[model samples]
Target: MPVDHYTYRVTWSPEDNEHVGLCAEFPSLSWLARSPDAALKGIRSLVAQTVADLRENNEPVPEPLAEKRYSGEFRVRIPPEQHRALAMQAAEQGVSLNRLVSMKLAA
Candidate 1:
């Protein structure tokens, strides 16, 4: 039987606008994006690279991620006044709320 595995949740604080970031609850790896879409893309790429590295070094592959499809979560808070502006940007770029906040923070 294949073993079931769990993914860690990464959280970011919206309290500080100057230095926002995504941190994995388990401290695996973190990446910065200019938008939620960018961040999502970055995370996906990171995981794929990690897998390739593991295989190249002949390291034991972790279950769950090693065999199944994976998805991650990203969250953010926005002020009521900025909702319209943010929505427009997200629609224009076709990204998520978490990504937009991350990208703005990164910039």
Candidate 2:
């Protein structure tokens, strides 16, 4: 798989005095370099090598998080008092609680 297909991020680390590259699908792996681009390149090479190693060992490689599907819906638990307040507010607006929450999230 192409390294671009994976979720990668580069961030500066004050402690290390360099940029660090991280791959979401391979949390345990990291690459540090003086520049962000180099860090990213290093991590990408590492990921490709790791995937190849896994394949050779007959081990399962994790799918890239960027390729995963997400449902638009998810559940969140809230205190009863907070729930009641939201419900009352939704009622005053002539909308369901779910609709109100969805609108707030979109904002």
For TM-score, the strongest prediction is 2
- How well is each residue in 1-107 modelled by candidate 1, as lDDT tens digits? 12113253334436532222232322476556555655555655565666668779998756554445556554556687798788789889999956876799889
Best by lDDT: 2
Candidate 2 Cα errors over 4 Å, as ranges: none
Per-model TM-score on C-alpha atoms: 0.40, 0.82
Candidate 1, which segments miss by more than 4 Å at Cα?
1-26, 65-107
Clashing pairs in 2: none
Assess candidate 2 and give its TM-score to the true structure. 0.82
- Per-candidate clashes, comma-separated: 5, 0
Quote the RMSD, in angstroms, for model 2. 1.9
In model 1, which range of ten residues has the least summed lDDT?
17-26
TM value for model 1: 0.40
Writing each residue's lDDT as its tens digit, candidate 2 over 6-80 gives 999999999999999999999999999999999999999999999999999999999887787988789999999
Scanning candidate 2 in windows of ten residues, the lowest lDDT window is: 64-73
